[model samples]
Target: MRQPGRQTRRPERRIPQSAAELARVHERALAEAAARSAARDSAAPDDPPFLQPRPEIGDSWERLRRLGLDPDAGAAAVHLGPAEIEHRRRASGLDPLLPILRGTLVEQGEQPPLILAIADADGHILWQEGERGLRRSADRIGFFTGARWVEERVGTNGIAAALRAQRPMQVHSAEHYLRSHHSWTCVAAPVHDPGTGRLIGAINLSGPAHSVRPYLLQLTATAAKLAETELRARRLESLHHLRTLAAPMLARVNGPALVVDAAGWTAAAAGLPPPARLRLPAEGWGSTAVHWLPSLGECAIEPLADGWLVRPVRPQDAVPAVPGGSDGPGADTAGPGAGLLAEQAEGARLRLDLHRAGSPELSVRGAAGSWSHALSPRHAELLLLLATERNGLSAAQLADALFGDPARTVTVRAELSRLRRYLGGLLAHRPYRFAESVLVTVAGPEDPYDLLPTSSAPAVRRLRAGLVGGTVRLPGTPPLPGPRPRPGRLPLPPP
Candidate 1:
């Protein structure tokens, strides 16, 4: 109790200097925040600096609310199945760099360093290694290999911060927006494709809050750069190898000639203005095939040592007419325009109901009547992406949207091949688009947060954020059991 005329004093908030202290600070902050949220009336003052949210954390909090997430709730991180995890590791092209990163960490000592993790641009943790004890602790919070840590999924953290900032960042204690993550600290840096400068993934180090330091952030950033440099060097070496193999072939070809990897990356070119890029169909170049390229028109494709040799075909050349979904060379001339006409004549309709939280479906209607097609989660997202794009998307663009990295064109091609078997002629190539003649309609989510809740693709996440605004019902999750709250505040949804 204060004496007469004496003023009451508030205790000073302490800055955490150790892991235990950080945990204590988080508990205090949680209690204080809960008190503020529970107040019936009175305006809450700004949080003290030590407890105040960082700019990125503040933005992430708003995103979490818009995504219909409860501040009090915790959810396990999404992880890929074992098979899918292996596929992702190969597709990510980061396997080569993993050993280097691990070696650097191992040199730090036998005590074992903080968790060293690598996540694809979509924030999927492709590889995670470090101290075994800490790994077990992290598993409780879903920080294992294959787990996803995108901002929308996990709130503010070093990985998400690095991706957004396109640099290194350290997230410590209450600086993290999610209460569950307040006990740890993380530092991360974005990695990029050396050729295109596109974000590929991120390299991160995480552990107890006391382990965080300025130098760790710098070290992570340097490691990312080194890894990217290694990738660049490898790509250049491949191109050099391609040139050596193509010299004799280029000398023999009479017209425009170019060598491209399986995913259509240019290796060597001569006599042809290097066409932007050419993504071959799933059949690859083992057999003779025709690929309609962006700048080169229709071209006859042939396999090279480690790539393909493409020669633009003149209109006068009497090649077999391009056939729909055919493997023969004749299928080259069946252009997008003709494909669209065929689809229109058939009058196909595609209806997609993606509003259902975890379950999204697509149905196709033709002369024989409509039938629902079973869609794998990836294909479901692919169809949704194509449905949104009226003009269609190039292989690289689609890859970027689907995998959060454009280099995954190989994966995109394989998946689209399966989708083609399902849709048949309704799906057209050239740019991997829906046939213009098809009538496609999608039933969007009533609440933006519900929009593709299962999809963590970067493109989908961006669209979700763009569409979600103000307040929304908890559409991503099941409704609360009790009485409804006010318009803006929604109960936490189950994972």
Candidate 2:
């Protein structure tokens, strides 16, 4: 409360009028923050109510310190060879967008020159171009093609920070963890695959610290967005091409049929409502052959230039004849569909070989013969959850069980779709589970704790910790009467 005769004075915020002044202010604040961090026992200490490093920069500094990185390290070494760099450039999805990035950030020829660098998801610089003097400066710091700029290698920098945060970021002067980079300023943004939402690479605009401006962040971000837009347009164009080619082929099919691209985007459909996409098997359409599909029973697949044509077999064409003569005891008494129904009831046999630590395989034996596929760590975790819960699990439930976050339903669905492509009709949806007729059997390691050794999913972790209540016994092994003991800590039979 102010006295009637006097007025209270509030501190006024002072805004820097030029980039140099701003840099000076940032340097002072960073010095104080760095001093505090150095004197503290913890990598991350509470910031006082004063000018300090931004949250992202502070977090990165903390991470670098925790990783035991030397702040005075020299220029980062280029670890990627020329051949490997070329391969990455072609596969990065950024190579084609170089022209757009150059036009937006490089070709501008602004007063204070800057360099443009593109790094793949792994933080290896694939391309860099800019004003001649600026390029030389960048080269002096090993900011050339094939140089790895990830935090683990070069300490905190724009490309590494943007990729780590999965967003646009700017690192200026002392904000960089390495003292060698203190004279440089960089602004970067991560680019993602529009179709799959996977980070492909990052675009960065960098120059001497004095050239840094607030607008550089937006400039880099705009360049990254343009690259994503181009990628999305190209995807749409490919889908259109597939659609045009599929029209006549789908028209000639008599029964339910559809055509889909390699990524499972539907191009055309006949005799059925077109699904936005179908989950194709992991092996994909290796050759034109008959394959069992979860959504369409049995389908004959024909390979196209860029996609596949799938036609479901009609019921009359799919049914097999009874083995015995019609005069046999039950043959004559049964209807024409009895044998098919019996076969359907018997279903398929599924065997999960998870006893080994690193090699997990799923084997299925049915009317189509036997085949097996190696399971990725994530797939193995999902299968384990489904096998344990015989009644099945909803998308949300599975998401919660796997990630400890029920809101990650989309991630759960995507993974399950890939799993279904290979499993075919053996797996079922609408609360994902093995088909009722599938004879599901699991073979875990002799030690329950050794199950899915590489899995970190919440469900797997809980099961390994003996937090899940159940009698999990391997085939021919006696069931433990009570809760299972954690592996490595106690002697226990495999579940």
Candidate 3:
């Protein structure tokens, strides 16, 4: 109440922080970050490269809080405005999973660290996944579901701590500077997409300090993997729809060039008819340098100075050879030429698609038409970069481009096993196996490294075309049929 002409002033909000609180926060940050760095180094040592920190983590957060920063309020004070909360929610991709994950925290199963709050990748709590009261209080203190939690913004918690460590972690009581969170222990692990291996989110278990042990970090890590795997399955199913429409335009392809060496044969030119070269029916015309497309049978094999090209021999001015279909100009069914064209187009498109698919997540194709791929997004990216380069990338080159830490080469190699499995599963097919490929290393073709998607499409096509087209020799005895109807008009007038 204003007394006459005097106005009342609102009390300023003071952060509750003891000296111990400050030290605990700083120590946890340095120690955890160092541990993660060491783990990364030990996991990758052959590469002698190094990296540096940005906007240094030291004192990044406490300094901001001390400055009374609240961008939404447009005032230098603590305020969790609606706009700010929404902003954080969107940035984190958290709104989709918040309710379900939060429900799990509250449900009567094995109670984990009560997730009082949860933030997205950017450290913003898109939704609180814990006790309502704790959630409300935390929200008031600016720890709602949708709010940033970068190390510099907020020090030491399941969210920031996990991101800082780049590993699963538990930041126990006293480790958090804000008095509001001192009663909690938060365990967090990053969640990634199995397909791309990108960090999508983090699942955190927050509860009373006594309930969560540091070793529980292992459990969170496993759970995070499961979550990621499930997401991968869903993503694959969705992407499959995009990849495999009902049209028979494409089929699962995998492997390297199927080679048939013609070292024993003589050479010829493309247009020039070599008197020594004999024309083989639809297929027999082929060379080691280049083979006839299996689909076009009995084609003339003409070898050019650069390579060999096979042209099909369709009978000149011949009628459509397709059975049980109209042979008119507007025939809608797949005629001989059309069938051959479809195959040609498919072959062309397959090469382009495989080449453009960017990342060869899986190198091997299996019989089942699926293949395995990398579990680490970083590795997948490295594989793509290596495949794209004129020369295959070395371990050091990959590490430097990916993490700016040349030491990550070992992790990259270790991760390839998982990538191989992923790739193998995705590209499963018979005759198109995805083992390590023997490609010409751009640096030195003889010094082959195995990160590329080596495909033997030509060889596979040869076998497939023969199997699909050659085996249609119907063996049953032929029976005479009833009188055929008149062309275009019925025989009613004659009857």
TM-score winner among the candidates? 2
TM-score of 3: 0.38
RMSD (CA, Å), each prediction: 15.0, 14.9, 27.4
lDDT of 1 by residue, 1-495 (tens): 111101112211233245454444445545544565532123246644343343344445555655655445545457799998888888888889987787655457534258899998778898887779989998977788888887767777888777655556777776676777777888888776654344678899998875555567667777876887788788779878888888888988887788986545677788744533343442334454875542355678887887888888853332222234333211112212222224332778787777655446666556423345223456667887787665778889888886669998997887677466446577888888877778888777776655665455666655555454322222223443545444322233210
Displacement of residue 124 (Cα, Å) in model 3 is 1.5
Candidate 2 lDDT over 1-495, as tens digits, reads 111101112211122134444344445544545575532233245643234455456555544554667777734476789899999999987889988988888777544688888999889999988888878878877788889998777887999877755667777777777777878888888787664445688999888887667778877887877898898789889989999988887778788888888755677888875555454543445655887654455678888868888887843344342333232111111111212332442567878888875457776667644445455556777888888776789999899887779999998897676565455566778989888888888888765545764444566655654522353454324576886544312222111
lDDT of candidate model 1 versus the reference? 0.62
In model 2, which runs have C-alpha deviations exceeding 4 angstroms?
1-55, 74-76, 109-111, 279-301, 313-495
In candidate 3, position 327 carries an lDDT of 21
Cα lDDT of all candidates, in order?
Answer: 0.62, 0.66, 0.38
User: How many Å off is the CA of 145 in candidate 2?
Assistant: 1.7
Candidate 1 lands at a TM-score of 0.52
For candidate 2, report its TM-score. 0.55
Q: Alpha-carbon error at 450 in model 1, in Å?
A: 12
